[model samples]
Target: MMAMENLKQFLVLLSGAAVFGIVSIVFVLTWVLHFREGLAWDGGAAEFNWHPVLIVSGFIFLQGTAIIIYRLPWTWKCSKLVMKLIHAGLNLLAFVFAIVAMVAVFDFHNGANIPNMYSLHSWLGLTVVVLYGLQLVLGIGMYLIPVTPASWRAAFMPVHVYSGLLLFTSVIAVALMGITEKLIFALQNPKYKDSPPEAAFVNVLGLFLAVFGALILWIATRTSWKRPSDQILHTLHTNGGSEDNTKVSPAMSQLSGGMDAEEAGEVRRRNNKFDDNTN
Candidate 1:
């Protein structure tokens, strides 16, 4: 059991490192390497560059981080309500950045008299953005609004969880497609007939994005990594006194019970199998 716990800790650390590394690579690739002069609204091609930077920073990295916020140890020390607000707030910022990036793309396109939605990347990207917007609205309505019935929230929980993961994956995919399209479009100086240094670097960037996405999913989905019900209640009680030490909602209680049952059953089965083998 000690060894297993150690292994899980190692995996979590490795996953966090991957997330940090990938986002760092994205920053270097966008700001340090490919950045050009006058990258502002009136700067023509430079203005379009914000699209990649913001999408990567906001949609890919921040959104991915938000998805795994529950897995963070520090977050387990805080009230679940506080963590929920942080998670929602991070996602909201990501959505805002994405919207601004979209505006940058359209502004550049119009200014340059270029046609829009001409590439597969653009279509996929636009679709992801629209779905993401819908997701934010539904999520806020279901989870954040005081008027939202607990029963309705409970019913929607599974769908909410599923769609959130789906959108995170889709955002990564769309980002990859966008990166590839941009590389092909921008590096046509030599017509991109062969592998160049810039092409290789950008390809690596895409790979990092893919790796980061996979790592986040791995961290978020691990049953062993979930915050226990006792921890949630303890944290709330410690932070906000007895009056605020509310029991978890039915959905959370059910989830906790389910996880506990699974762990208990697994242990019992292992012990029974061992006794049989010994006999």
Candidate 2:
């Protein structure tokens, strides 16, 4: 009953996140295609339109989904390695989109003779992107590389998780600042002060972004929703092991309290085999 209730809550939050994410993308697209000059690569305002569209769709939405991918119950049965690859793939795609968006902005600025990376929004956005790239590289190196020491992976896991979430939140905040900055610069006739339709529409987009981020964060942080370790699953299946005996190794818990059952089982099997050989 409790599990069912949790599942229901998770589904509701996931659905809400999906709705907000889609709406945010639509809002950004409408803002660019309808209110602005639409997309182009001509080093003009049209090219700049791609920046917001890609950022909202690829950077913000994709990254947020990737962050919570491991928490999905349906994928819990998959090997950790497989899930890691998927997670990395999503982040890589998001990074590519972010790079393109940055290029669009830079090209637009250069063409217009406008200064670049001057505002708080630009500075923070650039910083977050760089940090996100660094985070991705480090995560791949530490987690994906089999040669990497288990102890090192365990020690770095908390930092990796925290940094990912921090980057996710920071990007959304940067995006909100970015849209507002654009509105301030773009709106002239009615002005942003008069609360034009575009201004109101974009404001709602910002609200959607905020709500989406909140839902993703909530889903990611829930301990009960975390994947169960192989040890726990094995104990439940066998109906033999004591609660204390089924507890995961300190290293495994540190690595990921919710690490995939298959991966954990494989590691334990290997360890048991080594013990037998040593004996």
Candidate 3:
């Protein structure tokens, strides 16, 4: 069972890594393309236009969600503080995205030239993508980490819930913009009267991926095990999260305080066992 669980962790980590890798490759390719010949809107008012704007915007919004969620500092007796710290640090990559989104929206006129602001926004957007891609990779790492603090279901679920909402909003905004940009761009170009197949494909695929990711995160939030005595001793109680960290028994609290997080787990397990036998 332990081996199987470990395997699951490994595979999840690998999946996250793979996603970031792909994103990196795509970012590099896009940068090259933009540098050499720019995207379809390089010359028009839409140049530095809506599609790129939308993509960057979505990324930024996702970043803000990630920050608020990741900054959660809670290490209960069941989980380690260092791990939480690492997770939080990794999560800050999302902030880069939020910054980009704001830039993308700055002084962006509906149908006129925006070369100066666009240049700045584009540069900032690219930076956000690169940094936030690392956040994705780190998420994969966090998933694989065996010794995560015990506040999993409680500590992070709410964050995930709110973040999911944010992601939905960002994606919707970006998706609409992407579709509209394509329609208008296509309309303007008599050479190609029809909307290209890829616009629909990209927009649809992005939405699908975002939805699927949210579902997976929600599913992951369905586990929590707490010591009974800890609950009895504490007057304040919520689901089970950072706030409950200090409410643990003296031994668990002391050991957690004094020992390294990984070693502290052994002490915590023993204390839990003793508490069970006493009851």
Candidate 4:
């Protein structure tokens, strides 16, 4: 049991490190690549690179996927199932709108000026943000309240896998779109003379993939281990089980009791007396 527990703990930590490592890498890249002095919406000249935005969008989806995956059931529960499904669906919806927005923003602004595409993209993203907020509310309510999480419920296995599927699909879709939009803009921009679209794209895409890969590794490596509370659970379960068995044993034994000859004779005499009284 100790070995099993240690192995489980090792796997869990490895998985968690992979996820955190990816997030840290991506966050650092976002800071490095997109943190140019002129990134404001105002007339200020700023550095504009769409790759970081794309990667960030995917990172959020990845985060949501991780949440949904962890919450997904190892056992059956109607309540858990519904919440997981809704969480998955909402995140996916948010992902779709967010991707559209990422592309639109890239098209609308290439760091020179805020374009119409940027406004549209911003609006679209805002709408999805609303959706994500709703999801957050629903997800929380499921934990606290006693409703079917919302009107839909399902089994835990599908809830876990489907939520992840939705998250991955939505994020990757937006990320790819954002990347394309940025690349196209770079190709068309006149101010950026030294950097090749190919090189910039490769750098952005490479970092994004690397970060995302680490997170995936973590998710795949997940293993179960008993926490410090396991001892408490073991004791409670044992005592409760023993108490129940003690109570039930005598009742069961009496129900299975057989009468000896003398007892049977006594019972017959009592029955005759009762019959005589009735007559």
Candidate 5:
């Protein structure tokens, strides 16, 4: 059983690595080979080029990594608090990249006298970015802020998780749409439009994005993949040099062993909060 579990974990890790590799290849093929015009603020199409490159690297790829960070073997040795910080930080970076990418598009538009938000891709991209920013803020407030009430945290947890997955999916969808729109709009040549190498490469890139998202969601949604309570405790001890102050929540307690009356009450409260959220 132990060996089987280890093998499962290894396969999971391999899947994640493969996703990352595909993402990197797609990035290079899109930004480096197809469009060699590096980023520029005032260079019209060159400035606009940053949008896809940054969006894919930061929004899609890095964001996927942030979502699956918990499954990474390196995180097992780190304190949960540290992992939380890393998670938040990575997301913030992704958000920054997305914001800059959007900015690049706007800047290019103004410089080139082109209209903005004129396509389905533009509208969906804007909406995803806005919701993603809100998700990040609420996540930080709920999880990292020590003063947040346990009731609030419990109530918000489900929404947070749901919205995160939703937004991640939305980002990938928007990216695929954006690339398609770009291909249709920019590829004016008959040869390029009719099954050209660039078009084929980008279409494959879109498939990569979809596959990466699938692998990430698979790892994230697996119940057995959650951090073991014992591992969490061990990490806390290693980081703090003592375990006297760390308080495992009811959820963790339930995972570890039998729940005492107090823990049972806590679980009831959590359930009530969840019920309220459902309503």
Candidate 6:
């Protein structure tokens, strides 16, 4: 009953996050296509429009989804290796979107004879992107590489989790700053203080981004929603253990102590294979 209740709550939060993420993408698109010149690659303001659009869709939305992929109940049946690959793929795609968005901004600035990276938004935004890339590389090395030690992976799990969430939150904050900066520079006649329709619209977009980020953070931080250890699952399957009996078998527990779920899963698989070969 408790498991069912937790599943329900997880579903609710996941659905809410997905709604906010989709709405954020739609809001950004509406703002760009309706309020501003539509997208283009002519090194104009139109090209610059891609920056916010891609950032909202890929950086914030896709990246957030990737962050919480492990918490999805349906995906639990899949191997952690598969989940990691999907997670890395989503992030890689988001990174590609970010790179393209950066190019669009630089091209637009060069064409307009405007100084680049002068604003606080640009500085923080670039910093976040660079950090995100580094995080991705390190995560792949630590978690995906078979040569990596279980102890190292276990020790790095907390850092990896923390940095991912921090980067995610920072991206959203930097996005809000970028939106405000854009409004200030673009809204000369009516000014942003007057709250023109575009300003109002983009503000709502920022709100959606913030809400989406919050939902993601909430989901990621919930210990109850974490993927069950593969060792536990293996034990339950072999022993026909009840769902409530989460305690691993003695051998599995001994092998998995002090390791994170992924590392423990690796060790469990190796031990099982060794036993099978010996038999």
Q: Judged by lDDT, which candidate is best? A: 2
Residue-wise C-alpha lDDT for candidate 3, range 1-279, written one tens digit per residue: 013453366346435534543453354235325422344433343333433443433343333233323212122222434544544443454444444434434434433443343443345444444544554454444343556544543344344445544544444444444434434544444322463444444444445445444443432332211122232223223323333343333322211112334334655574575457448
Tens-digit lDDT string for candidate 5 (43-86): 48878888888888889878887886765554556666677788
Clashes of 1: 0
TM-score of each: 0.77, 0.86, 0.42, 0.44, 0.79, 0.88
Clashes of each: 0, 0, 6, 1, 0, 0
Give the distance in Å from residue 50's predicted Cα in candidate 4 to where it truly belongs: 9.4
Clashing pairs in 5: none
lDDT of 2 by residue, 133-239 (tens): 99999999987888887767766778998999999999999999999999999999999999999999999999999999999999888766765554544443354
TM-score of 1: 0.77
- Pairs that clash in candidate 4: 38-46
Ranking by TM-score: 6, 2, 5, 1, 4, 3
> Clashes in candidate 6: how many?
0
Worst 10 residues of 4 by lDDT: 248-257
Query: What's model 2's overall lDDT?
Result: 0.83
lDDT (tens digit, per residue) of candidate 6 on 59-161: 9999998998877767656776788898999999999999999999999999999999998999998999999999989988987888888878788777888
Off by over 4 Å in 5: 1-3, 6-36, 191-193, 230-232, 235-279
Q: In model 4, where do residues sit more than 4 Å from their true spots? A: 1-134, 147-161, 187-207, 210-279
How accurate locally is residue 65 in candidate 2, as Cα lDDT from 0 to 100? 90
- Model 6, residue 67: C-alpha shift (Å): 0.6
Higher-lDDT candidate of 1 and 5 = 5
TM-score for model 2? Answer: 0.86
